[model samples]
Target: MQETPFTLRAGHLLPYCMSDSNKTDFTNPSTFILLGIPGLEAAHIWISIPFCTMYAIAVLGNIAILFIVRREPSLHVPMYYFLCMLAVTDLVLCMSILPKMLSIFWFNSREIDFNACLTQMYFVHCVSVIESGIFLAMALDRYVAICDPLRHSIILTNPMVAKVILAVVLRGSMIVLPYPFLARQWPYCRTNIIPQSYCAHIAVVKLACADTRVNSYYGLFVLFGVLGLDAIFIAMTYIQILRVIFSLPTKDARLKTFGTCGSHLFVILAFYIPGLFFSLMYRFAQNVPLHFQVLFPNMYLFIPPMLNPIIYGMRTKQIRDRLLRLFTHKGP
Candidate 1:
């Protein structure tokens, strides 16, 4: 069999060879080496500081959101329930890669088992798709509360919320399940080295020595299916929400109604805009630097998770008050 194809190492694109003795490294190797941010080896230590801090904040913030939602009986409603799900999804999404990633950065522990890489690939996208769905649910929750307050509780009962969560999980799983399987089917010839710290689906697929058109098309399918469909629904929801809010008689009432939605709007933009930008840049911007290619994806994955709970905590009065009380040792 032929040696491995061209590989990117430390910002240089160079052909790498694996002789007959190491040919098992062809097809499907036992391990894939993760080179954390090629060309930025020196800065890996510096990069790890903020990345580690963000991961810590993401974990703690999401956990706090979960804890507060579960503890406060008053938060046992649809919006807070959806918030809890979002926290769980964000928490899981960040956790799926960060620890292993930090290990790569700090200790040069870069080798991941072949199957383990696939598992990480599955989880990253799976939870991301679920996170998108949660945003949709949150948008719907706002729509019902503002436009049809009388039937809000009736429309989004506990069973309905539970079903929505189930649908989101199943939908995300089904959409993302093909990725790892497809990656596994392709014969990987001599290249088990990934450029990024984590198992990004496209990066993994590109490593396989096979026709990748089918994989690319399926990826596009998932991307448009998730972003396109969700964007349409969310846009419609907000348009209606805006119309109703504008129709309110008093300025104070209008301000109040839109005020409640401000946090969610910021969050929706925070989540989707960066996602869309990074995804487009990843696919189209080929001439960009290697370090950028590495940096942006990691930023895309962790930033929203870090920002989410902070946005909610700062903007939502009840959560802020509760957090203050928790710190100040005040009564409910």
Candidate 2:
């Protein structure tokens, strides 16, 4: 067997005894550099303050929601069960990107191993897609609760909710798993500098020396097929919900119905608007400033996780009351 020219040293690949034949072998890059907030290097410190604050809030808020949901037997139903799932996904999503982001901003430590980058990309996209699916499921839950109140319990039983959560995890994993594989198959002879705080799919894919059309198309396919479909279904459910609300015999009933959906609507808008804008800007607005690109995508990742608990806490009376009581209660 012909001996390979590269050797591993301290987990870093180093060239050794390179010969003429091996020079053009297109050796895969062992590491990739992340460029965080390209034009705002001087402001990284100022930027990190807010980023750190948001991350802290996201972590604390999600943990609080998880704790409340787990401790309160009243929240054992399907709706809060799905909210617990959302909190978990948000926690994972924030943790996946924020640590690396803060590292880049504070320490300027941007070099990530090839496999680690791929792993981060997979989890980021997979959890995001799963969150979208959860939104759709929550919308359906609202639809049944308001539109068909008498059968809501029958439709969303414990077994059924469990199945839906399982399906969501499977679908998101299946859709996003191919992305890292496609990336791994490509050679990164070009510069391995990824122009974002984290290893976003498009940012990493565009670095490949090989043709990325298939990867690009498949990404857009998953984007539209999964997130797009979820959006459409959510909209449909809300439309039906509106019709039901407007047809209520009393004004109090209509207000009550609308109140139930307010939090979900706020969360859906918060998640999708930034997501859609970022997706479009990422694809079409190539000439947009680098700082805008970096800032907004990070916003897409951070804002939802931080705001979700706040929205729920303020909008949902039960959660709000529980939070108030928990804070106000004194130990004997």
The numbered model that scores best in lDDT is 1
Candidate 2: Cα lDDT at 224: 74
Q: Estimate each model's TM-score.
A: 0.93, 0.91
Instruction: Give me the overall lDDT of model 1.
Output: 0.80
lDDT of every predicted structure (CA atoms): 0.80, 0.79
Worst 10 residues of 2 by lDDT: 1-10
> Tens digits of per-residue lDDT for model 2 on 7-61?
0001112223333433343545677777677778789989999889999999999
Cand. 2 Cα-lDDT: 0.79
Mark the regions of model 1 whose C-alpha exceeds 4 Å error after superposition: 1-25
62 in model 2: Cα distance from truth in Å? 0.6
Q: Over all chains combined, what TM-score does candidate 1 have?
A: 0.93
- The candidate maximizing TM-score is 1
Clashes found in each candidate (C-alpha, N, C closer than 3 A):
2, 0
